[model samples]
Target: MAKKVAHADYHGPSGGWGSVRALGAILRREGNAGSTALALRRQNKHGGFMCVSCAWAKPSPPHVFEFCENGAKATAWDLTSERIDPAFLQRHSVTELEALPDHDLEQAGRLTEPMRWNPVTDRYEPVAWEEAFRHIGQELKALSPDSVVFYASGRPSNEAAYMYQLLARLYGTNNLPDSSNMCHESTSVALPKSLGVPVGTVTLEDFEKADCILIFGQNTASNSPRMLHQLDEAARRGVPIINFNPLRERGLERFINPQNPAQMVATGSKRIASEDHRLRAGGDMAAMVGICRLLLDWDEEARQRGEAPLLDWAFIRAHTHGFEAFADAVRRHDWAAIERRSGLTRGALEGVARHYAAARNTLGIYGMGLTQHRMGVETVQMLVSLLLLRGNIGRAGAGICPVRGHSNVQGQRAVWITEKPELVPLHRLGEMFGFDPPRKKGLDSVEAAGKVISGEVRAVFQLGGNLVRSLPERRLLEPAWRRLRMTVMVTTKLNRSHLVHGEIAYLLPCLSRIEIDRQASGPQTVSMEDSTSCIHASRGIREPASPHLRSEPAIIAGIAKAALPSNPRLDWNAWVGNYDLVRQAIAATYPEWYADYSRRMWEPGGFHRANPAREREWRTETGRANFVAPESLEADPDVRIADGEVLNLITVRSNDQFNTTIYGYDDRFRGIHGSRDVVMMNPEDMQRLGLQATDRVTLIAAVQDGVHRDVQDLQVVPFELPAGCAAGYYPECNPLLPLWHHAKESHVPAAKSIPVRVVRQA
Candidate 1:
């Protein structure tokens, strides 16, 4: 069916009556108006489940209604009365269901029972939980441990994530490919290299104290709606908020607090961005270079005038190293190249740089827009260097805030869920788990895809996430998945990934965070860390969508016991019975921040994980923060475009979307209503290419690879974006990104900056 497109006036401000109306529509559609409302009120509250929508840290002593519009949608979708039982599966064959859209597949509702793919009939039939585990166990026991890859998403709780990784390690493989590899792995890789820590140093409290907040490549109002409240507060306080992005997002321009009745009914909304810089796609590095170059000049000029300099010289000299080399490289950068690459006038960039120089305390916040590019790591490091110039790292209301995507992605890594064995304190983990940890580095998501294609990987297991939709190069990934001997998905709802099965496949239904998990130890609560390092408890209040569903930890335990029956060290039943035992194991493995995990969790707002970088303590090899010099500003050397009508493409999430999970076919904030198959382009670029708004066009990738990749019949909409830059929804456009195209250091797929040519459909 053709996806409908209805254009609505762009949502004036992020929130207000519009949000209230949307929330109502979602609840009514779910047919559980009363239950959904109660669930939403409980979200992010004391003794309530953390929102599974976005990882925005809940405010300390959260508000009465702490949820956002998107959170309400997710809650309604999760707590829907609809259920996918054996009868439903029997009616819909795997081949038939595979033809449905992602939204339809999930809207078919939550999976209620364990199902095994019947190759003979090409259907999924109900299988006993034990039999499903036995099949997975049989496959793993037959294949070499290294041949099995375990994929995880960021949505799972800390307890579930820890158990998932521990099971993989105990099963003798480091092949843990996670969602971070596709999203914020660049932040993880770059921060540690520059600031001596993988995580951001800033806390939510910093939002209040910051004199200025510089936002890069993130639409906070839509992605993290609760953050709009913070942004609104910052704007009302007259703080200078600067934004850098290719497209002018409404969320960055202004926001209306739905919680504030006076503001909602009185003044409409508060102006957000003091200045918005429209940098070209893949131009963040050049822009950062330009800002730093101007800052360096300002510092020199201030010194010549016998005035206090903008640079924090004392902090630089005492706590940082290699400043001269980095500053020299900044000086050597050609202004003409920076202007051309960044698509910004030198005067405009310098104007913003001066504002940055004036702020005593600044907060640098960024998202996937900056991290999903070719030089993502370099761009992140440049951001760190810019902050370090003013000693922003170790002060109140000042630090790098790489706003994370998933609920507990940071906590997942906090408990060590990475593929790199060296990053883990192996001896300590081994001591806790009573086994020798794997020494070899494992494949990330992209690499794992390649291995699957090459027949090197025989078995696949996913904890939580839509691997096929989330990963790049779906054309190649489809065939690779089919080649696997066995595939297992532990998921709560139906998704496209469930249809892409191997010869032997199992779908194990797991409980969602909004659903109660009554294990042998009674009702249990799972812990999750937010974007900021604050850790808190999440206890589901509502009953499960289905009685057949099991807790994620319990499911993992069952699989682990079945897979490694002879491994006497693991007491799966004992650990799964009581979640506190799981937290105890986590604390024992990493004694640093998690010491007394259970005791400290009861603290008012949950405790902040210890971060030495917050105190100006550089834990780098040289015991000081290092400033690395960037050789150039170009992000993608592999991109080649024809002269006629090629443009840089960035696959973005619509306001109605979250990490490959589509809530609806509407992006109200962007004026795109009831449509997911639309391309956003600058009007000038559309004119140059002989295209008009609503014109049906085919987007073909401009790469040398022989494999063809194109998404056909996309509605073209002229938007206020930089010329030569086009934006489209992700997963739909993910095919344009090849498997080999990724960031240099972090190996994250370059989904944001793809080069493509436009062809008008006849």
Candidate 2:
């Protein structure tokens, strides 16, 4: 039924000579081959710029070369010599530029000055900073505050995020949606209800003490490469690492530390996982339920045998509620149903349970794989329930770790960049800032897009992100974006969002993380919080790309001054002149966590924010951690299909990509080269569908929305995946995801699993 072809597989270990070669190539491509070495040495170190890559933690006593290959790419991307001046903007029309690919659009270089769209000429022309601010002010004054949306990427510093939120609140709106709304909003919503904390409880040091590590739906090699070192060390110490995912990611299989010369040159590599379980996409919840059922059964057997019970009864009685109800719900789930939903046999799930029960302290780490589904909230709660069975919370080397993608995404939420007003301290903000903040719930990413389509939202203020490319249903959102009355983007480089501009769109160039941000006082330092809740100082070592570029704080202040009425209570100029004033305000607002912020920021490795869950102090309504249960074994019952030709599609990112930003065409780890327009499928499924390797096909969504959503001209590649399951690159496959298909509670787009039918091209 199928035609056979030669398979291209990568046999090398992760982070060996391949990574070194990739880094060298990126440096040369960006024309930073000479000065990049010094920059790499200073990255993630004290008194140096933080890596603008992932939110992986840094060691206290940092290594000389603490950065990874992707980190090198990000730095080179920021420090590239290419510049987009007025002449460059004038040379190409908006229609002409929109035809270029995303990578080429970004490669056009960094913005050199403020520019405004000229509808008459269909091109962007340079404008003065003062004039741009005045026009933005006038436009804002004309529209209702509720009709404007303020969106931020995860790249902004804590001080900038705090000021940006303050500006929005002072303008009488709570519409502060951010990057977190798209990625980790499920974690934010589920963790607080389950653990009494919205963030992870474990620190970087926990890896050393963890007896067993359970990773779900995360690719360390591609998403967070710096975490490989911790896994390598844990494996060397004989810790059991049980990984659960549909794909056997290279990072979780074996790792060769580039920092270790002996390991790099050796033929062998360090084994990272003790066992890798291939579960179906969107089956994380089912697998968790299966493991919990086995643990409950084992506990009963141990109790009947007059031995110690497997579950932590003491911890459960003391620090948790609703355990009995959760256990009862687990008992109701049948093995046949679990196996059918999870695509895992009972024996495999038993092995996972055995590993989890054998260890005294276990750690659970997850990413978007679990959170980008329809039942994302319930799935996260199930994982928390699995950990609570053994009292994993608040224990050394044991807790939940939600590996965030952006460096300061969690920190942005910490500084009140959220739609839910109750999560922030409104009373304190009002008393300190001398204004009453809005109480109405604001719009999230999905809600904002829907409102934009309906002509409810008239303006958009983007801090720093390619919002057009990142959100789902790009085919619909891109055209609706142009309907806005005004759009202002404060960014470092050009992106697809710039081309899909509004009637009155303005682009304001700003300093990046690796560039100097000097104020009237002296050289200023910005703070970022890692995924581990560790906040540290980051200072730039390179000069600004353009002399006209301003810092994020300055740009926000300029707009605030021009838009709102003069307020004696707030000093915008002083905050911009000395960043310490902004830090002081942050310390005053969140005294319990950020008191003496400036002094603590200068510490060796900075300081960890206080988490009540880590201290066994429950902040939930019941005054204890809660054990929540899912209603069924199926994660997405509404979209489940029984048809043989229909497959569950999981949108993935390439090794050369981060979020929506594409660095190169090669995913060296997956053996994909020259293009990202391919779909990976199981060989058996290809044969069943009468398809072969290199066959051209189109993926059509199986939804009943009456809208035909399909991605055409995708080459099918046979890979190691479960039957009836397929994988495709994200943002490319994002078109097949309906705007209405999102998590029930969190509103995050369900990009991980979409039911699709593959139609062969003639």
Candidate 3:
């Protein structure tokens, strides 16, 4: 047996938000100048245009000295002076590494070699690339493609994701689940049904000219620091920016623009929000419905007063249908009912209404905070409705902005992986990969994870992802991974997913986007679309850390060769060697924007795909933007509302994090120092429980099944959030979210809303 060390949570020496700042300073202390420069250069060259972390950033790119405290940490940690080689693996067994903390293992360094888990030594051992490929092919060949699930992380390049999806479908399965499936699957699934497209309706420029901005679920200050500039610009223009969330986030509350030298010197910053509304989590859809109800009610009152109506009759008549039913639903629900559900008084709700009538143009921006609940799909629809009432969607400076979470999550989804589409624009995907398209819908992320855990899934080939930690329900996925016949990961760094040892597990290190790719043909450039739907070319700026790292495209090509050695259906080498050929295939099939991908991506800002829907040109069967009115604006399971317990436990990301991966321990804006153990609870809840700011508590998730999934202790911090609501760190609080507890339509975990009971620790 091996002795283990307790996991350290860095609570500042004084205990509180001060510790977070020192943690940030300590993180910068680690020498990372070289990698930092390279990473910064990538952002400048490629990253300068749009953030790779969250949404389509509208502000000008940050300069060398312009990094936010959190962005500085995200970049710094990625460029750290550490390396994980086979030697590290030799020193530690698989069991031992699995026991190590996620941050501790990553802090060791970037993985430097291809590794395989050895049963004999119970450790991971290095193997030649050829041997690993051969073993992978054999295992894949033995299983049916339908039985295998391919989980993709957003970190992979567009070309890599394109190739990975192609490989999975060609190998005979469309079990393609990704990070988007967990976060924005609601937007992906519901947007097309309502808006005739799966992406956001607004472009980046919309943020600049909008008279009013209603931001929901997203903590812009923490997640996409660059976007704060847009809010600052909006404020300067006197635009009323309204924010809604359970916790009163520091970012949305007030942002001190680090870019403003005068402000920084004065120790004062720009205010992003003119007014903020802290609505209970899972109450967003209802609050939005209240706004709609107010609009409709005002229109009715105007008719009685012989005054002008609140709705844009011209736009509504020309662009939409179901207005009758939509208006009917809004009319049925009044201010009192909506106010009761939303936790905002009728007066406050009217304030939101007054802002709507006052602003000629408005922009609505949302994040997973809105899309990760049971009403995720409905919430997205309500926002669409909110925009449509004033006729915001088709116009400039007013539209719906679904802030995508990963650097290129939205971009990748555009390039390939069209799961639920009528036509699928598959000509390009088909001709490029040289395989007949599998005319079938496949399992989504939650569905795939459920299938895997239930022994229905025999194998999994995740392209650049950490599923065990990346997804919800560790209790489910951990055991499911062990039962896998084979598990293969194509990655740039070693992570928790690498340790989910199967009957046969292999970790194939791949090239990062920042590294040079030298193939037999020549150096290659891959294109990725930004959240705003602008595409750009990304070529490596630095050499690979080691010669062993293969590009994701090359790995997919190799896997294709091994999987279909004698298949006449595919020419794996042709697509792999000359990426241009793949681009040509894309052009031949999907000519919307990628008709000449090489030429288009070469342009400075890349090409914007034609958005016919931008002009209210719906591509749906009806050829008009349609309305989807839910029977009830209310959704989500009945959260256990104890006398002193919290109802909605929404999960959120900090500045030092991107989704599941932790970059560091500092969340500067949130006043969270050194550790992620603190949970943000309403001050009223604290009083009810006799808790203070730093009171530690044991949180047992109120699951319906009576199963204490991943119940753990979390420190309680009294925040200015609304009563009955609380916020906690993700992947830590992820266990509290059940695998089965996802959105009704999207199947994404309801991380935004969970029932919880807290007790002061003994």
Candidate 4:
């Protein structure tokens, strides 16, 4: 087998001509230059389909080219000319396809029709949509509702997600787990506990007014490129940007705005971060605590001098509770302990604290880096608690921003897509839907995988996303998925999950977001909520890749009708015909929040979902903002390595990849090319471990319990990372992450902070 030539170079800056070249390459490969151009123009624009990329909020007055390089790639990928027809499926066996790469499977192009697994032949044969749904219905009905798990990806529109969750609920199961469980479930759990809201309080316009913004554990350029424009503007306007992460990201260093004519012409690129602190993988919580401790000591000194206090005493007294306890805890945090845990000197943290204290309005930004840890929820709360000390929430230009990845992930949660029945009371949901929803608890992603492995889960159905590629401990999870009685995947393209067959497997082709979705009434439009909670409609402008492909809503509704023939209370078919009716039902479900959802969705810039916390009105048990005061912050207590080199393995997404989907093997931002099978470590650590760059090494999981797994043939790359911390690409390195190693409160797998031992492969 021939592999693409791998290359490495020192990555410097972001955007400029590089972005243009990347976009051009994708468009040329797509071969629909004209249509791809139009799709790119319409993306993130008013009345246009939302970009199937990151959840970055569209500006009120959208830019001429609102899409980024990766966003353009996503659009082109969805609108590719290649198609997986019946002949293609007939030629390839499931076992043969399973051995191929993730990119290869998706590159085979959009699925044209429904496919069913043939055990006798071991190939996926074309099946009618009706027949496929009927078979799934039969399998689902044969088992208990609790025995089936319905997993959803983050790419679906609000209408589709709401309908899918409703279908599961109507079928008497609350086992609704989503991509959020794997990524930012920490934010979804932590924020509401302290700030009375799960979503971020900052608006898109907050960037302009902020004096300083802290970028923690997120590569803004690769993950959310459109944010480079905002970061460039902030840097140019003299706003100090502070970055805290284990690795030195090129985006955090400097960025040239591709939209800027001057920068594109090689005038110069603006530096993004004024101060960059390379904190260890699990050191974020300790770093935050160190900053808080300094702030409190400074406040006490200011009070003794009869000068104005640094703390917002008035706001604290009026709007916050438990400040005294929190302050006491901060004062008690030992500088030595904080320094040891954070891998930063006390003076360095104090210097950063001074800058934090000087800024009138500061925005704290983070991503999966902070959330994919054992102390993820607590880490988020510490940042929130820091903001509360200065009365940042509800204020102009200052608040918390988790920086979600999916387009409608936040919206899906708002509409109630979770396993917990208490989130939205069953009685209230029953009154709106006219059917009593199941009250029993449901399994999360990890627990669901465990059930599947235990042979307790009879069936597993995925709306989107690659379960085999996204979940942790794939070596175990994949075999468990194979043992299922039935497996169904509703997707636009073939992925690794499609190859993992059960006793009975079905693949239902669905229309991509860039494709036209026509139903019984007329062409339909779906809505998605961005990171800022702005709800808008997404109407595909181009013709669909395949005529046989059905829209996601239509497929979900079809499955609902087939699965629940006895209950005629909900008209699933009629509702699917007109998505407006779905929105109307959503409005009826949450009359107070979504009173006129259908009308509001069509508004020019869309409408912002009402959040009382954003307006300074706390809805907690105390009827005010709460503060959590912990004694210490430590992530992994079981990481004991006395002999070999122990590295804190942090899983990261490559520049060309989005979650589990691999666009290409090149990660331009990190200087890694044509390969993700490598580990990045600090030069000092590499020297200490007697390893050289490009040396083959095997990474063994250093877990206290559970099955230990090892990833071999990983090339070592000495990059500018913190000592004792090594970075590896996700899905491949997911096997090293123990399933049981997760956050206590949120139950999110600790993908970012896996303790591992690195040794040269013999």
What is the C-alpha local distance difference test score of candidate 4? 0.85
Residue 232: error of model 3 in Å? 1.1
Which candidate has the highest lDDT of all? 2
How would the candidate models be sorted by lDDT, starting from the highest? 2, 1, 4, 3
What would the per-residue lDDT of candidate 1 be over residues 636-693, giving only the tens digit for each residue?
7676544658899988887777788888888888888877898899989888888988
- What residue pairs clash in candidate 2, if any at all? none
- For each candidate in turn, the TM-score is 0.98, 0.98, 0.93, 0.98
Indicate the worst ten consecutive residues by lDDT in candidate 1.
Answer: 1-10
Candidates in order have lDDT scores of 0.87, 0.90, 0.73, 0.85
RMSD of 1: 1.2
Model 3's TM-score against the true structure:
0.93
At residue 80, what lDDT does model 2 achieve? Answer: 89
List, residue by residue over 1-762, the lDDT tens digit for candidate 3: 111112223322121233235334636654566556445545625333233345443323334443444544545555556777888888888888888777676677667778888889887788898788877888888888789887777777677777777777777776777788888889887778777888887766777678999998888766766667677878888899988877766656665555466765565655678878877777787788888888888878998999988888898899887888987877677666677677787777789989988888898888887888887898898888888888888888888888877777776677676455343565555665566767677778888888888899888888866788867778777887898888898876678888875888888888766667787688887777767777777777666778888888888888777776566755667777778877776666677667878787766556677777787788766777777674665657556565556557878887667777677676655666667876787777788778876666777777768667645556777676778888888877877778888888988788888888887766
**How many residue pairs collide in each prediction?**
0, 0, 8, 0
lDDT of 4 by residue, 1-762 (tens): 223335466456788788888888878886787778977889998878889988998886888899988899888888888888989988888899988988889988888989999999999998999998888888888889999999988888888888888889988999999888988899989988888888898887888899989888898888998988888899999998989988878866878777789787874878988989988788888899999988899999999999999989999999998898988987787888898888888888888889889999999999988888878888888889999988889888998998998777788887888888878656876877678789888888888878887889989889888888888878888888888899899998999888886899999988888778888999899988888878888898888878788999999988987898655557877888899998988887877778898888888778889878888999888888988886566865555435447888899888798888888888888888878888898889889989988788899998766587999888888788888888999888988987788887788889888889998976
Question: What is every candidate's alpha-carbon RMSD to the true fold?
Answer: 1.2, 2.0, 3.8, 1.5
Residue 89 in model 2: lDDT: 91
lDDT minimum window of 10 residues, candidate 3: 1-10
Off by over 4 Å in 2: 1-7
TM for candidate 4 is 0.98
